[model samples]
Target: MVSGHLFHCRKNSWPPEEYVGRTALQLLDLDGGSPPEQAWRRRLNSHANILKEFSVTFMEAMKMMTLGVRLWSYVREEASHGRKAPIDPFTRERCKPSASQGVPLGGMGSGSISRGFRGEFKNWHIIPGLCENSPVMENQFSIFVSRDSGNKKYSSVLAPGHHEGLKKCNDSGISSWDWNLSGQHSTYHALFPRAWTIYDGEPDPDLKISCRQISPFIPHDYKDSSLPASVFVYTLVNTGRDRAKVSLLMTWANSIGGFSHHSGGHFNEPFIGDDGVSGVLLHHKTAKDNPPVTFSIAACETQNVSVTVLPVFGLSGENHVSAKEMWDTMSKDGHFSRENFNAGCSMPSSSGETLCAAVSASTWVEPHGRCTVAFALAWSSPKVKFQKGCTYNRRYTEFYGTSERSSSINLVHDALTKYRLWEEEIEKWQDPILKDEKLPEWYKFTLFNELYFLVAGGTVWTGQDRTLDLNSPASTSC
Candidate 1:
C-alpha cells in the first residue's frame, strides 16, 4: 500500500543561524484543560517571518480543535544550478491536497503516512513550514484532529525536529508527557527516550549505535517531562557484528522529481519474485540540497548492505569509517554487479510522471543477530508542473535490480508490502502493548506514544532568515 514520493535535501542542511525568531509549533491540552488550555496555545511565531499557519487549539472530548501549518523553509545563500545548497526548500508554495483524497497526514490502521509515522515519532520533515521568511527546517509535520462534533482524524506526526534519529535536545524539548487530544484512549503523545545525545563534538570514535522505542501504555498523568521523550519501545542494537549499519535520512518538501522512490526488503526465493533490497541511496537533479532540499536514505537493516546512488559531490563521508571505501565507491560508479544481488529500495513504477515522496526500511541480520528495521514515510504537496531540464543521471545504480541512481525517473515504484511491513506493524502494535505490563526481556521492546502525554517546550531545528533580501530575486518575496 504505497505510492510515489521523493527525497533530496541539503542547502547546508537548512541552518539559518539556528533559525531566527523561533516558535515553530505549540498546541496544547493536557487533560486538565479549561483555561482555554492555558488560554489558546498556538505559538507559531510571526512578526514578519510571515510563514505562519500553526493554529492548533486542542481539546478532545471536551471539543474545540484546530490544526494548521501554512509551512516554512526557503534557504538560498549560494550554490544555484549545480546545487548542494542555495534554494529548493521545496518551492512552489505548498498547499496541494487532492491525490485521490490521500495525505492529510495519511494515517489509520497501521497509521501509514505511507510508512512513516503513527506513533513514537522520529526526526520527520515536511518542507520547512513552507518558508516565506525563509531559512527553515522542520522534523515532523501532519496532524489534523478536529472536534466540534467529530469526523476529522489524523493523530500522529506532530512537532518533532532535531533529526538523525534523535538522541538529545534538551533546553525544553520537554518530554514528561502531556501530548494532546484529551486522551480518550490516546490520539497523540510523543517522547521516546530511554537515553539521549545524537552526536556533537567529533566522534573521535563512537559508533556502535543504540535506539530504543516501542513502549506505549500511558497513565500516571501520562508521566509529564524530565526529558527522554516519554519512552517508546525502540531497539537498535549492534554489539559485536563488525560492520554495522543504521541509517535514516529524510528531507522532503513539495516534490515531483521523476516519480520519487524508496521502499524496503523483499528477497522472496523459490519461485523467483526478485524485488532486490539494499541500504539508502538517492541522487537526483545534480546532487542538490545543502539548500537545494529533497532527500531520502533510510537504510536500517540489510545484511551487510551494499546499495548505491551517488553524485552529491560524489560523497566524501571519508568512507564513513571505511566499509571498504563505502563498497569501493559504490563499485566505481559503474553501479555494482553480481547481477543485482538481492536489490531493493525504491519501488513503484508505471511511468506516469509527476512524483516525489519517499521513505525506506530493510533488515537482514546474522553474525550476532538482533535485527529490527521499521521505517515509514508518506508525502504529497502536489500542484506541480515544472519544466525543469537536468533531472538526474537518467538512473544508474540504487541497489540495481534495474540499474538507476539518477532517473528510473528519480524514485517511485509503487509498493505492495515488503520491508517486513515494519516488523509486521511492530507485532501488531507490540502485542496490545504487551497486554499492559510484564516487562523484563531487556524491558520488553519499550513503549509509549499515543502522543505519550506531551509537555514538550522545545523543537525549532536551526534557523536564520532575518527575512531575506540577499541582494535580489525581487528582494526574496515568497
Candidate 2:
C-alpha cells in the first residue's frame, strides 16, 4: 500500500479500490468552484485514467502532478501578467517574436539589419562578417501628409504606450523626435523574409498605410540571396473625401566600423541610373583611389510620384540649422529642396563621427484610391577582414567581384529589377506548406520563424573553391 499525502484514500473507503491509482491526482481538487480549479480537475482526472490504464503506480502519479503544478503556475503567470500579447491576423493566434525582432533586412551571409516590430531600423550589421547590434539614433522613417482640413506629420515609430520624456525639438531638430504613434493604431505581422505593418485609426481617419519589407531569401536561389539588399514597398490608401499628398522619408547614417581611416572625410552624391532609378550613395572613403564600402538608398520612379534626395545632412540634432532645415523641407511640401541636391559636402569624421543622408518619395492619392511606392537599401562591402590579420572575400564578390570593382549602385539595380521574380519564387515555395490542412498551425509558424537565424546570427559565407573539378557532370566526380 502506498503512503504519504499522495496515496490517501477517500474519507469513506477503508481499503483501496480499483481506481486507487487514479485517485491520487483527483485528491488535489480542493477548490471545486473556481474555473481554473475545475479545468485542472478535468485534466488531472484525464491524465490519471491514462496512467492507470498503463499501470502507473501511486508514486508515478505524485511525480507527474508535481511537475504539472509547476507548469500550470508558469502558464498562469504568463497569461495574467502585464499587457496582452499580439495576435496573428490570419490564424488569430497569439504571436510575439523573441527580442522584439521582426523579419530582418538583407540576404543570408550578407550582413543584415534588424527592423523592430515597432518599425525602427536598429542593429546595424552592414560590415562584412561583423555584427554591430547598436541602434543608430538618427536612422529614421517618417511620413508627411497635406490634406485640405489641415496638415499632419509623424515619425511613424509605433510602440505600446505613449512616451512621457520631454524632447527639446528646438535644440536638436530631428534628433528630438519621439514615437508618437500608439500601439492600438497599428498591427505588425512577420512571416520570415517578409513582414508587414498595417497602420490605421487616429491621426488620420481617412488614410490607411501598410508597409511590406522583403528580403531576397528564396529557397535554392544562392546568387540573389547572397546580395546585400532589402526592399520596402509602401501602399497608401485614401479613404477620405478629399485627395491626400503623402510622402515617405528614409534617413540613414554613414556608419561602418570606421576601420578605413581615409582622408577628406565621407561624402554623398546623387545618381540617376540608366534604368531611371534615382537616389544617393553614401561613400565611406577608406583608400584614396577606391573606398571600401558604399551605401545606396534608392526609389523607383512612377508617373505621378516624385523622388527626392538629400545628399548630405548633419548627423546630430544638435546641429540646429541642418536638422531643422531637413525637417522643414519634408514637412512643407513632402519633398526636399533640390537646391542642395547635388551639393557634395566633405564630412570629416576623425573623432568617430558620421553624417546622414535621406531620400523621399511623394505622391497624391485621390479619395478611395490606392498607390504603391517602392524603395531599396543596398550595401557593397565585399572585402571582409578579421582580427589577427586574416582577410576573406564574401560569397557575393564571386559574381560582383571585389569591393574595388563593385558599387552599391549595381547592387541596388539588381535588387530593384529582380525582386519581383524573387517574391514569386518565395510564394511558390511557401504556398504548399501554408495551404496544408494536416499540419498544426503552431508548427507552420515555427517553420518560418526559425529562418531568422540564417541572417541575423552574424552569418558569413565565403567564396566557393573554384579549382575543385572540371566542368563535368556530377556523376563524373568522386
Candidate 3:
C-alpha cells in the first residue's frame, strides 16, 4: 500500500504504522496470486537485499517512492499549465492510435505538431536614425605648447598641415625632424600636424587644454565582416619640448545619430610619452559592418593622431539557456561527460528526435593606435539531427536501451509494473482513509498531493499521437 508519509511529513512516516513489521508473505494472498504479482514479490526481495547492503530502512525506501510521486506531479503541472488544447483535442483526426496499440498512455504516438518559426529580423531603422544627424563626422583641432617663455620664444608652431607635408617630405627631412633641437635659441622644432599644434616650441604645461568638433558623415554604406560593428578610436601625439599639460574638451553639432547620443563616442586625452612625447586617443561607435562614422576634435595644441575602431555583434543562441536549469542539472547529474560538451551541442531540428551544435567567437581592437573602445557580436544556428541509418543507438544507450528490442521491452514492462503496483496500493488505502477519523489539514494536503500525482504521472504507453516527426530530415544547420 502507499506509505503514510506520502500523506504527511511526521516522524516514523513510512509503510503506515500497521504495515511496519509485516513480511511479504504476510501481506500477499498466495492462493489468489497471479504471475505478475509473484514476479513483483521476487523483484522486491532482490531489491531488499540491495537496500540491506546499504543499511537502508523500509521507511527510506518509501521516501524514495514518495519523492518520485512528487516529481511526477510537478511534471504534470508544467505540461498542462497555460497549454491550449490540441487543434483537435477530442478528435482522432491527426493522432490516430498506432496499429498495434493496446491502450496507449503518456504522450506516445502524438503526430507531428508544428510550433511555427521564430527569429529576430534585423531592422536598420535604428541605424538610419543614428546615422542621419550624427555629429561624429565633424573635424576638430587641438594644441600643445612645449615652453611658456611668456609666448616670446614662440617660433613656428607645428600645425595639422605639417604632418601632411612631412609625409610627403624626403628621408633627410624626416630624420632632421626626428632629431629635434632643444634650447631657447634653437630654431628647429619637431612638429606632427593633423589634429595637433605645438606652441612656443614647448609642450603645454596644462596638458588638459584639448577640444573636439562634431561632423556628420555623408550617409554611405560601409560593410565588412572583419570590421567593428559599433565603436572606433583615434590616437593623438605631442612631440613638444617643455613639460606641457592640457585639458581636452569635445563639442559637436547634432547629426543623423544626434550629438547628445553620439557625443560620448568622442574621447580625447594627452598622449603618453615613453621618453617625453605627447599624444591622445579617439574612440568612435557605429553600426556593424558600416562605414566609419566621422567626428571632430579641437585642442589648445595639436598632437599626432591615430585611429582604432572596435566592433560589436548580436548575442548568440546558447546564451539563452537558463542559469537555474544548468545549475540544477549539473548538481544532480554532474558535468555532462559527453566527449564533445566543449565542442558544442548541436541544435535539433523542429521535428528531430535529437540534435547537436555549438557556438564561439574571437575579438580585437581597430588598427592605428586609435581610441580604447570596444564592440562584440555572437550567433548560433538551428539543431542538426543524425543522418539516416546512422545508428546513433550504438553510441548512446539512453536513446534505445541495451539493445533495441531488449531495451524497449524492459522499459515498457517496468513502467507498466510500476503503474500497476501504485494503482493497487492506492486502491487498498483509498476507501478506508477517506472514511476514517478526521485527518489533519497537513495530512489531507499531502494525501491529495500524492493522489493527484499518481493520477497525472507519466503514462506507461504513449497514445496513438506523435508530437514530433522523427522520420523527417534533420536540420542542415543550427
Top model by TM-score, which number?
2
Model 2 spans > 4 angstroms off = 1-98, 128-130, 149-170, 257-264, 285-291, 315-321, 345-347, 350-352, 404-406, 465-478
Candidate 1 lDDT tens digits, 19-106: 2121111111111110110010111111111222333344541352121121121233323332222223335443221111111121
Candidate 3 weakest lDDT stretch, 10 residues: 111-120
TM-score of each: 0.23, 0.70, 0.15
Which of the predicted structures, 2 or 3, would earn the higher TM-score when compared with the native? 2
lDDT by candidate, in order shown: 0.22, 0.59, 0.21
Pick by lDDT: 2 or 3, better one:
2
Expressed as tens digits, the lDDT of each residue in 166-225 for candidate 2 is: 244454445444445655545555666776655654246567766667788989888888
Native-vs-model 3 lDDT?
A: 0.21
lDDT tens string, model 3, 279-337? 12222233233222222111111233221111110112132322223222222332222
* Candidate 3: regions farther than 4 A off: 1-141, 144-241, 246-478
Q: Give the TM-score of candidate 2.
A: 0.70
